[model samples]
Target: MTTTAAAVAPKPTGSRTAALSFAGTLRSEWIKLRSLRSTVWCYGIVIAITVLFGILIAQTASATFASGGSLTQEDQQSYALLVSTLGIGFSQLVAAVLGVLVISGEYGTGMIRSTFTAVPKRLPALFAKAIVFGVVTFVVGLVSIFATALITAPMLPKSGITPDFGDSQFLLALVGGALYLALIGILSLAIGTIVRNSAGGIAASLGLVLVLPPVLQIIVAMTQAEWAQNLAMFLPDQAGGRLYAYAAEASVTGGVIVLDSLQGGLVMLAWVAVMFVIASVLLKRRDV
Candidate 1:
């Protein structure tokens, strides 16, 4: 028999992005995010926990201040912010878990292999997932914080902690708080991408976002070193929290904050950016 020319598939002719468009990746990611039951439940729980703790804090603050309980103006401001954000740390855990699950679940279930096959250039896929998830988190957090603020408004006035929603500074602080949560969500996604394991990602994320800040604080407390104590405020979570109050909080470092509220928000954003860059590089270099 005559030798026949072996058939070969045509190579992609366009740029990688043109050949494997991000629109498809973005659509697929959105679909995948919605399809997962855990996504719905975790978000639902996040919302519930946020509101539940807010109510409890409001009630507690109301009772504590009902008799015009010992309160200073400065303390009232702090307490107002605290009551409004009581569930932030708790909801952060839920958001962090969801972030880890979003990426790590694919690896855990062998879906990542299929994913990489569809889009050989992996970083776009990761970016698409992050953008979709980050936007969702930001929107949800904004709405939740707005609701919490309104719900706790009655209690705040009673506690002499009233913050005028119309006041730009107060409004900025509220917006900053929600933005902070959204950043945490994205940051956790970076952790998941880096680790490529569900539990490991979650644990690492919690450790970074929750445990490390306090541990730093403890170190400061134990050492009582001025430098060490002030350094604590520069950590991601602490720096982010600085944006949650109307006034610039005293530096843990005992130095004046040269940067304003917007700068503090930028600090948190910088942390997320660094993590994303690292995760993207690793995602590109590593095997699925």
Candidate 2:
């Protein structure tokens, strides 16, 4: 007790690590996406809905054929794409929710603070999340649509419908489906960033994806204006639908009902770009 004071231990030096690179942020986002139970359930629902609708439509088409009704090659192809993709509109909503959750859930749970702290550069977090959601949803959608098409092929004979996946139209449909879902996912991510509340994000995303198009359609009908129809076609859903057109009719003005497939893809990209810009600005300005 009288001899010497105990030597005081030196505090360990804390190492400051550099901020996470963009790739690291993307990996983190992926990890977060896959760790959530809801992600798995939502993806499963996408596949299930796609397959179920495909089978149902194929069966119905088969019955119609069995009744001796004639279906043209074009009609058969349209039906194949339509039936397999019937769930697309609904699946977009599911994707929207998933997208919203990816960002908003972090905010709701206060995990965003940790994310921001680690990344420091806020925009990368948002970008990384967008990329993660876009890629995941796109791949999932592509696989679902492809599988649905395959399943529907057997039923096609009953409908007097034969589809070749090797065909150009079928290939376009597959690619378009993937792009459409990816766009929807990105749109939802932007809204989630803007709203920050999960419910608000989901509501706004769904409203844009579903509600707005119909409202625009009604307005266009009421107006009976050429410009209105042109404008309405640019809406995200309508523009995206243009990519899968097999039998588009002429509008009242004698112009084709469909936009060029390349143009339609560009239009969809424009929507994504606009929202992405807004989201980036908001994310930069707002506190976590």
Candidate 3:
């Protein structure tokens, strides 16, 4: 029989045909991040430093008050801000080291080969890792800051330092501190991805974040050069430091440049953006 047979087509299976989504990549990255013991230790150290330092500062201020030392309202606010944010200076280094370890560890262990293989278009993995790490870091930083504030709030009253929680500037300082930590971590991650070695990544990250600022300060002190001072203001640490600075007034005076929170944030974002671009390009071109 020469009957025409109906055309038949194979239906695609959902599992085989489904593409790897960014959300799926993010979830995978998050799984890897949370599974690491280093992540737990680093985050623990961050929280401990923040809370413990806040306690120490609050106690010191309380003792001062008990000994009859006094501060004006502005000074009190300054002290409160310091208590809440003092740990950020130290915590940032920890966060940076953690950031480096996150990527460099993968490379060190050769898991990056598998990582890239799973996601043939490698940039998505890089971005997924960055986004996952950055968001977690920001949340952790925020929690640590707010926890310190809450723990120290009662103690501050003993120092005649009552914090106005509703004040916009005070709230901004707290939020800014967290934001700075996130950016610093992401910047370190970009550095780590480019370097692709744990020790080298750490050294490079610290050189830029820790060593450069003080070196520039020393040069400024030696020469009192206006350009040197202005240049230092744009360095990552210096610019990021302004983000958490409370009630920093914009200087209209010549030879004095002060970055408000927004200015500092933009500058720090620029630093991260530039490094990330370089890292992305290298990651795409380099062999795993």
Considering every candidate listed, which one attains the maximal TM-score?
3
Q: What is the C-alpha RMSD of each candidate to the true structure, in Å?
A: 4.6, 4.5, 2.6
TM-score, structure 2 vs. true: 0.90
lDDT (tens digit, per residue) of candidate 2 on 1-288: 589879998866786466678999988999999999999999999988888888988888877777776777778788788877887877888888998998999999999999999888798888888888899999999899889988888888866788866678767877688778888888888989999999999999988878887877797778776666777788888888766565443343444255766777788899889988998898888888
Whole-model lDDT, model 2: 0.83
Off by over 4 Å in 1: 1-18, 69-78, 249-260
Please report, in order, the local distance difference test score of every candidate based on alpha carbons.
0.80, 0.83, 0.90
Candidate 1 structure, TM-score to reference: 0.85
Question: lDDT (0-100) at residue 255 of candidate 3?
Answer: 90
Cα deviation of 156, candidate 1, in Å:
3.7
Superposed model 3: Cα runs more than 4 Å off: 1-17, 67-70
RMSD of candidate 2 to the true fold? 4.5
For model 2, which pairs clash? none
Best by lDDT: 3
Clashes of each: 2, 0, 0
lDDT of 3 by residue, 188-254 (tens): 9999999999999999999998898898889989988777788888888888988988887666346
Off by over 4 Å in 2: 1-13, 68-70, 247-257
